[model samples]
Target: MPPTRRFRLIPGAVTVLGLLLALGVPAARAHGVRTEVLAGPTSVVTVTHDDGSPLADTPFTVLAPEGAGPFLTGRTDAHGRVAFQPDRPGAWKVRVAGADGHGAVVTVAVDSAALAAPATGATVATHHAHEHDHAHDEAHVHADAHAHDHAHDHDHAHTRDRWSGAIAGLLLLLLVLGVGGVLLRRRRG
Candidate 1:
């Protein structure tokens, strides 16, 4: 046999490694998000590629402010544009698709007030409401859009959120088992 093994890993290093692994796993799966608001009779939300190019022909859908919706399905054009026409004069449910390597779904406002007012004037420009306006369209959201792309629109964030949580839990279990194995080895030694 070669020289007796003298490998040592400080407890602090192990702790740090565990923490880093726990944190890194989530961030790695975290998806990019973007929303664009076109102010008009029908406010179109264009979900772009990460490269700022269009997301062409991606299947998408939209709903009205109320929970009642046989959803209006759409597909992104060559320009990555999904034009949604609000069924009624109120806050509309704008759900876009994510996780197909695209991005997250989002809710946006569409009505006489939101559309008639140019997106450049009083509020849309100042508040960036169109870009980051969750508060604007939350209260009027429909319950049916829960399984779609628009992040704030749905109760279920995505299928990935649930699976991610399960994987993290399993990782914790494995880490515990690993630590137990180490302890058993040390005791035997």
Candidate 2:
């Protein structure tokens, strides 16, 4: 009786061990897909599996040229593709993939000018454009202000207030004229 019971337990244990091996091996998928854009006005890159299927739901990030924009974060759609504009206009990179396991990265090279980053740069030839001098905001750094930056936000509120004041004055004048016209009409009638 003891031998029969032990033999039954052996079959159950073997079944469990087989199940673990079968599931665990492929479950740890260290495999992946990657994509990138080549030669175009629109900076684009794509990633796919080794089999060419779109790598869906994967996270992607674009590190634009210095002083271009903040790190752009996006996920691949059904087509396993994402896009972001570079910060400046030289050697840029687009990193893509996820880390359910290890992860993957894709880098694309394109010539771009980062007019926002505060660096020594010549636009075309003789004229050197240094952007940092005029950009006085403490929050803006060298990388961001390389191109035409948001240094003029100080004037944004001022402009809005000036326009509001002008609009209000116009509305008041129109309201006064409307009231006067109504009164005149009533008197005439």
Candidate 3:
């Protein structure tokens, strides 16, 4: 042979490569909470762990626009979701806390338009409760209206309207997850 050559791996170079790989990998996210406003006065709340997995059985409280105490209290289901309807229209606050002191608060506003609008082709039940300033007596009005859009179709639209909120919330959650995944992939590359 006219010439001989030898090559050796450098420890520093290997270490640098390992560090790069580690930095490129996505780290687990911290525990967080997310909320979405569904149709009408309904809202969906979700709690997740660091890895984006659902945190079930978490307790949550909802405060009305004007109240000294919580208006509604419940725990998240298996999918880390809890649906609640605000008693009155205005700004509603939802607070959730984990056992480890991890918690979040979400605020949502409800408008009169949403409350006044009735779902199409659905039975309507309206209840109004008013407290008189001068008297202790309270006025209550309960109106139940059942209307059929089409006689041939017996399908109920109220059921579908109720689920629409849930479906919307789920879609929002999926969208957020998808965007987060894309960002992580981009960073890795």
lDDT of 1 by residue, 1-189 (tens): 233332344566667767875776444434344456554555667665332445667777777768576358767777666665554566565566644656546566555675565433212211122243433332222334541344433213323443466578867987999999999999999
Provide TM-scores for the models. 0.43, 0.38, 0.46
Highest lDDT: which candidate? 1
Q: For candidate 3, which ten residues in a row score worst on lDDT?
A: 135-144
Question: lDDT (CA) for every model shown?
Answer: 0.53, 0.50, 0.51
- The residue-by-residue lDDT of candidate 3 on 67-102, one tens digit each, is 899888988777565566655678777787888887
RMSD of each predicted structure = 11.7, 27.1, 16.7
* Pairs clashing within candidate 3: none
Give me the runs in candidate 2 sitting further than 4 Å from their true place: 1-34, 67-69, 112-189
lDDT of 2 by residue, 1-189 (tens): 599998998789779866864564343222434343432334555565533455777777777556356368878777666655444456556666567652356554545443343343222210112233352322222236532244234234333444455557657976999899999999999
Segments in model 1 whose C-alpha atoms lie over 4 Å from true places: 1-31, 98-101, 115-189
